[model samples]
Target: MAAIIAADHVSKWYGQVIGLNDVTLTVPPGITGLLGPNGAGKSTFMKLVTGQLKASKGAVTVLGEPIWGNPSLYFRIGFCPEQDAFYDRMTGLEWVTALVRLNGATEAEAAAMANRALDYVDLADAAGKKIGAYSKGMRQRVKMAQALAHDPELLILDEPLGGMDPIARRKTIRLIKEWGRSGKSVLVSSHILHEIESMTSNILLVNQGRILAEGNIHQIRDLIDEHPHTVYVKADQTRALARAFLSEDDVLSMKFEDGAVIVQTARPDTFYARLTALAASGELGAIHEVTSPDDNLQAVFEYLVKS
Candidate 1:
């Protein structure tokens, strides 16, 4: 499949500070998560993709056309930025209608589109409510409504799930999945690992203004597993559990804390299999829980950067 967005040696800097540093990437169709920490140049990259800001060097193209200085391309792209900027006095319907009208939609057509969008986001009842009166979640949905009102081919959402409650978050995630399933492309950026995990396995990891890694999350996790992994096991007999793994060659070290056995192993797959067998054998006391503090996106990014 052709890439929906592409960058070649793209770099963006603001005066003395660097936002992106010689980054190159291609985002395919369907939903791709832009995973990175704050100040990781996610916003800068998204801005370049959306044509909100020009790259300091190199090229950025979306849907086979250069994004910068391309006014007509805006109609095909929907952007829900992280920052909140709304007309507090205007109703949701009015706010979305105004945005759609800017896309050359007729007044009546804009209103109809706005209504449908509001309904899709489950905000039809609040369409007549003033923006100032809506909750944080409602405001987020309203921004999404405006983005969808124009029926763009690609959606560039930056932290769209932020500030939303559990129900609203799930609903918005479903909507994003639905959009991708409909054959549209979505570049959704978020710092939360599980959020992106639930939406799509395809991800691009960014850190310190550079692309660290990009691929399926499972593939990335497998790469990360090459490094030492620390797993914590809480059980009634921590000492017994620790002793059981002491003979294993892959077990690097062990420690005890708060009635939990913390084991460091170079081969976590082997360690986990042994642990599961021991638990099933009923030799060790009841095992409460098992967790790996290092098994997360942030840790994975750190490992990638250091490697």
Candidate 2:
């Protein structure tokens, strides 16, 4: 797939301060999660891609055109910034319609688009409510509405899930997946690992202004050998499995759950190998399923950032 956003040796500095280092990446069409903690240059990269900041070195292009100072390219791009800035006095309907008008839609067309976007975000009922009166979550929905109202090819969202409730978060995650399935590209940035993880398996892990890792979350977690990996297994004979697992010295501990066992081991490969052999013997009954619960961005962060 061709890249919608491309950055090669891109760096950004605020005077003597560095916001991003020599970071190179290509974002193809689809939903790609930008995973990193705060102050990790995620925002800086978003700004550069959205044409909000000029790169200090190298180049950045979106849709085969330079991002810097190219206001026209924004017609094909939708941006939801990290900040909470808003027109306090304007209603959600007014605010979203104003933004849609920037896309050259007629007032009537913009109003219709605004309503459609508000409905997509499940905020149609509150479209007439003033921004100052709306809760943080509602305001976030308004921001989302404006981004989708234009129906851009690429949606660039910065910490969009911040301040959302669990239900709203789930809805937003589903929305992102829906957008990707519709064949549009989305670049979403979040400091929370699980938040990004729920949105897409494809991730760009950034830390200290550099691209640290990219690809499946589990693949990245596998690279961290310093921590114990936790795997959950469901089996017909739980007691038999526990007895066998407890004998393995490499397994640090074991926890019993309803019809399942959670095992922590420093050597995952050996543990998996043993499980395969034991399952083949039929002494432990049938092993229904095996999964690594911590095979995610949290494991990678615990190793890369927390360690």
Candidate 3:
């Protein structure tokens, strides 16, 4: 499938400070998680696609047209910025309606569309409530409502779940996934790895203002696994688990640590499978807790830097 958004050797810089560097990528019709740290050029890439910034070099296109100086293209692209800024005096409904009207809709048409957007985010009841009075999660939903009011073809969300509570996060994730199933493209940016992982398996990993990796999380995870994974397994049979792991070919090393057996393995899934059967057979004893401190973004970052 042709990409809805395509960047060809794109680079952006603020004088000597680089924001992005030779990052090439393509986003087709589906949800894609933009994974990176605070200053990892994620926002730069999003801004480029949204036409908020002109690329310092190379080119970027959205829907077969260059995004630079293309204000008209916004009619089909909705953007929720990373920073939260709002008209506190205005009710959520009024704010959303006003923004929709900027799309050239009449007051009546804007209001109707705004109401539907509010409903989609489950903020209908609070539509008339003051923006300043809404909870953090509600405010986040309000931002989403404005983005949905005109029903754009693509959604460029920067930290869409930033202030959401657990329940609201789940609801919003479900909505994002529903958009993908409905065949609407969504480019979601977030520092929360698990949240993005929950929404989509496809991801674009950026670091030092460059594209470090982009593919299925599992594929990247497999490559990162070459760095060796340390899994802390807490169970009554710590010695037994250690002994059982000693015979495994993939096991690199094993040691006891703070009431837990720390096992280093190159093949985690296989180790997990063996552990599962051992527990079921009443051999490994009761497993209480399992934790892999480096299994998240830190591991990915470490592997990227080392490589």
Instruction: List TM-score per model, in order.
Output: 0.75, 0.75, 0.76
| Predicted model with the maximum lDDT | 1
Off by over 4 Å in 1: 219-300, 303-307
Ranking by lDDT: 1, 2, 3
Q: What lDDT does the true structure give each of the candidates?
A: 0.85, 0.83, 0.82
Local lDDT at 208 for model 1: 83
lDDT of model number 2 = 0.83
Model 1 worst lDDT window (10 residues): 288-297
lDDT of 2 by residue, 187-272 (tens): 99976554576678889988778898887767553554456767777778878888998888888889989888888887766776
| Model 2 regions more than 4 Å off | 219-302, 305-307
Candidate 2 least-lDDT 10 residues = 289-298
Model 3, CA-based lDDT: 0.82
Count residue pairs with overlapping backbones in model 2. Answer: 0
lDDT of 3 by residue, 1-307 (tens): 9798899999999999999999888887799999886778889998999999999998999988998998899899998887778999999999999999999999999999999999999999999999999977788889998997898889989888774544566678899999888888999997645557778989998877998878786766556556566766777878878988999998998889876888888776676557656756765676655545424455668666777
Model 3 stretches with alpha carbons more than 4 Å out: 219-299
